[model samples]
Target: MTAARLGPQERDAALRAMADTELDVLVVGGGIVGAGVALDAVARGLSVGLVEARDFASGTSSRSSKLIHGGLRYLEHLDFPLVREALTERGLLLSRIAPHLVRPVPFLFPLRSHWERPYIGAGVALYDALALSGTRTRGLPGHRHLSRRAALRIFPALRRDALVGAVQYWDAQVDDSRYVVMVLRTAATYGAHIASRTQAVGFLREGEHVTGARVVDLETGREFAVRAKQVVNAAGVWTDEIQEMVGGRGQIHVRASKGVHLVVPRDRIHASSGLILRTEKSVLFVIPWGRHWILGTTDTAWDLDKVHPAASRTDIDYVLNRVNAVLKTPLTRDDVEGVYAGLRPLLAGESEETSRLSREHTVAHPVPGLVLIAGGKYTTYRVMAKDAVDAVAHGLGGGVPPSVTDRLPLVGADGYFALWNQRRILARRTGLHVSRIQHLLRRYGSLIHEVLGLIAEQPDLKQPLTGADDYLRAEVVYAVRYEGARHLDDVLSRRTHIAIETWDRGLAAAEEAAQLMAGPLGWDDAQIAREVEYYRARIEAERAAQEQDSDQEADAVQHGAPDIVPQATTVRV
Candidate 1:
């Protein structure tokens, strides 16, 4: 069956279809796991419909450490199974599934003492050994112990007092937001009807069971009664809220912990390999991101604003002071170009500290028609998706085929490996630099042809974005056309790398991006200008908040600007 892509006009048609019939699964959220469940369920010959209140990956999925590791720290907690499962998925991602997106990254774990050398080395050794046991991991290398001399060869920026030696371990990195977008697209390709900016308000109940849901289209003030046999709630932070919607108290407690990261020029930390420093409470990473190095991530408890977690001066100072302990050239507040904060939906447990909460995700049948999933790391999102869909299968009320999503490849996965060999030719054909082509390949994988097609049609689209020059103008159009981008920020921030890549943090490129999306989304001159100004205000508020010393102060400063008008905030465009 050819899958449906719900264009703007088709929104009414799509909602009508939803109201007129029954679906096997109605996924409430549109994050990584919900998308995965929709894809998995549809591929198994079930009818699937997924809706997101915001753009795809607009939440925690978009803001991540960008690593797809097997959770090396989880081993310290003796969660060997969790680590192994993550490694298995990591291998699958690097080798077969989304190979274009996930790639190997070596991390240097500095050993401060001589005893630390053997202790950490043994842990990393076990980590790699576990990967070797997996099917798709043989292509990657094993762990290597680095002498103090050998370690300095790779990272000369390390302070002499920082380490006695280092242990190098292999992991993977990804564009978390792009990956989720890909997940949504792939699910759509498998015959799932997905519309972003569509909110599920209340349940459409039939006697004791929730036969469907009452939803409001955020773009147009239209109401919908989307009918389905099963509704899967993959809303990360709002799982509890969704539970309350169905008159059920949440079975599992999910506490939100804020993790903040800062982006600085790569030269700030002169290191060939990524740094994974052990903090007193949690681990801090100085991961290499394109032309910049992204760092910081305090695992402190945050109960304030979950939607916009602001990075205060204290948070940034803590990360800088901790990571700078090992840097030969220390980083100051001025070195920071961009800072972002995300709330982690940690599975609530007995541990008083947020850092101690389990990274493991769980699924529960909150009601006969509703299934809830939350609290997992980005790397293991596939497992969480699979598990959520599996729970949905029980509520389908028929003999349904088993989930074969593990064997199923994402839409762009098949030809991505082949695209790698012919990237130079692709660059030559498109009149783009090999570096630019490589960037698109990593982001879009085999779907680079789709992005390239946009450039080919409008030759001027090949030009790079003015302020956020690393991204091409065609990417902006593609975000609106294919990736379901609804607003200016959606194009500049999540769909492309422009947000964190630029020094101004996408403020300069916002207008151009909005203009590109306007044709597809149908925005007028006044609306486009409003979008640009709003994004500038958001960036300004965040910058002001980052200057504050404490979370409460930061939250006060950040939230002072005003509420962001998400399309779902009202119903009209």
Candidate 2:
């Protein structure tokens, strides 16, 4: 089967089809859950339309800790069902669903005291057991205990006094934003109309039932109506705001909880494995990325701007301080390469603290033709999508088939294992190093050929990007030609992760990448300069925001860089 193409022309055609065709389900939001819902619905023989207000996974889905695990901490809270369900999903993703994008990463949980070993070990044993109970958990290694001396050997960056011992366990990691795009691409392949940079202004309702939506293309300021029988709101942090469009609060409230992460170069930390530390409010993860280590997350209540969640000086200090307590050589602000903050859409409970709020999603059909699915983690998106579509199936009422997405591998998954086995052969054929071929295989899987094809046509595309050596020039072109990237920010921030991966926040490659993208995007000299200027302004704004102490101050500073794709000032839907 041919892979789906999501280039500019295809996106325009999708938008036109969404306006012209009557769909069975219209999924609003382009995050992981929305993308999953689109794939599920279309796979079930239902005509589907997926619309996003911003770029796909620009919100919380893009800014996660990048772990696909069973929520090990949730076991302490006795949320067995959530943990079990997530573990099952983790197994499926590792083995079946997206082997290319998702792979296992080892995490060492340091024990502070000798007495804590058995206690923590029991929890981890349960975690591994739950995962193994699943039918597809064959490849991942189980948890193992290591002596303090042995643990220190594996992670020399950890202070010897930081732990009495450690427990090592496996969890899968992903390039979260890329995974979302791949899911959408798979859905598009299955015949779903998809449009990004399109804002849903209002619901098209007939007497009290939502029939469709009034959407505007942010790129071209063109407004049109998309007609559908059922509309699913998977708008993440913006769920409550979308619900207000229909009438009342819609029987569910989603609270925004902010989480922050810091990216530091790998050489700064002499650790071979990732580290997971327990904190006062939540867990802190020092995750391993390709050329960098991702240290994150502070869980705090946030009521500020949701579009651009800013990580203030206070938040950065909190994370650094928490991780520094265990590091042999503490990481200073200068050591940090990037900082990002994302909001978690928690189902508002009686608890005042967002950390205590449940991650389990809630589905509600407050009205006849509308469904709202909110408050799940990145790991359980497929389940949430299945449930959302199941509700839509019920609403549709007939011989609507159940979800077959579990059996359906994503577009890149089909020939991945075979290609992975032949990485050396591919390296010889492409004249690229074996290590480079391995990187491409991990990213594009079987679709690596499409990327190689570009280099095959133009050998210059094989050269590494200007500042970000890990990525090739071919990737920047590929993002525009096939992956639906419209602006310089899209390529740097989401498509290749050059923004967070580089110390300059991709400023060094801004002009080079924009020039590369200009050819495919049909940008003139003026437009290319404008795109570069916008990206630089954004980097400066974020840098200034990081220096601020509070969310309010940071938000004020960050909003200085306005979005290129202007959204509606006022909503009628």
Candidate 3:
């Protein structure tokens, strides 16, 4: 396999190559599903090109709940197939695909009433059984029932009267943005042409048949055409917009459902395991992230600003009130370190509530030479990719091979276990702490050598960032040099997650990170200053938006900060 270095040089080469060649498949999104589609198509031996208007996973993909489970709540809806498929993919990710990035996390489902134990217990049992029923190895432990005392012992933060008992079940979690980048990297290794900050402005057509796309490099504002035999639209919430570029609506309509999450310090939540609480409209998860607890998710209709979904004060208050009901020590607004909102691309349905819409995906050849895929959960991204590529194959007269992604390990997964075992030795050799080595192993797996190589050349790179101590200075450099992070936001928001993980929302680290990124990205002092200013403005805008009472007000406030790269407008062909 080729080295999956998505640096500046590789990105330039990809753009030139994509423009020069007529690809067998061209994908129009860089979210998880689009990344998966690229990987699946390339692994199937097709010439593939993937373009993203912004950074990878900049949309809904990066803003997920970050769980890889069988959707235990889906069992109540009698959606066994969706749950089973997600479980299979979850197992594959943990064991075979991206072990370095994904790991199992335990969650406590607090039982409210005596009768609810047996009711929810059956659902949990079925969830476990469905996981086992899959062909892939079940990488997590089974669920366990706990008495009230045992539940309290494990989760002392829970209010005494809140639960009669609890059920502890295991699910996998991942840094969603990082995983998307890794997936694209793996796809690049398989010969997929990958380029971020490139937008599809319009579709190329030959007398009503979609043949390719007219694209613009967002960084340089250079317009070009990428000719492709088959075009796959995995544009998630922007599916309708992409379809409109083709001059009409596709077979399905995608509606945006806003979900908001609050990040609080882990010390605030005194639990050995994460909590899954029941809400009136949907389920709420208090997930255990590194050194922090991610409490969230308000599901409501959102029609504004798909790119930057804003979490209103009402949304934050709703989450706090819901989680506070079961917590012994109620959390306040002051406890929140960060807030983020993402839109779910649900297939529009008859139900008025966004929560009632389908999580299942659909693929349609709305026009010849064009395939549209939308509306799937994150965990089942591979399956969605496979199906989308299958549609592409059919469009290309059906000669494409089956998807080999299920058996293919991502770039960092192959030797992760060995690297993990030798972390202490690595630490000793590099004069770094074992904990630091372990952290690198979890994030980069066998690819830790690539990061350590930068540190070997510059000893100062080993030091942790001033604001986000969890990450090293080398990470910012790595994000620019190897991970295709073109801007400060790419590193702070997606690549390193310093934006949402820090108390100051990465404001303190912006100048340093921009300086570190300058050498590789060729950003002069002016550009560096501009990058820092843009990030600071973004942080301020988000803070202002979070204070608003409604989504409309919040969205308007969040839009105050213009995108660092001007958004490309779609032109009608």
Give me the candidate number with maximum lDDT.
3
TM-score of 3: 0.99
RMSD of 3: 0.9
lDDT of each: 0.82, 0.92, 0.93
Candidate with better lDDT, 2 vs 3: 3
Candidate 2 displacement at residue 138 in angstroms = 3.1
Q: Rank the candidates by lDDT, best first.
A: 3, 2, 1
In model 1, the runs with Cα more than 4 Å from the true position are 1-13, 136-139, 562-573
Per-residue alpha-carbon lDDT of candidate 1 for residues 1-573, written as tens digits (9 for 90 to 100): 332343564445556667777898898887787888888888888888888887788888888898998888888998999999888898888877788788898888989999887789889988987787786453467778888899999899999888988888889899888888787777877777887778988877776677777788877767778888888888898777787777755686788888889899987877798989998887999899988998968888888877778999898999899988988898998888888888889999999999999899999886678788998888888888888877877777658777776676676777887788898998888789999999999888888888898877899999988898888899888887777788777887788867777788898888888888888888999989988988888889989998898999999988876534554432110
What's the TM-score of each model vs. the native?
0.96, 0.99, 0.99
Least well predicted 10-residue stretch by lDDT in candidate 3: 133-142
Clashing residue pairs, backbone N/CA/C < 3 A, model 3? none
What is the per-residue lDDT of model 3 for residues 347-418, given as tens digits with 9 covering 90 to 100? 999999999999999999998999999999999999999999999999999878898989989988878998
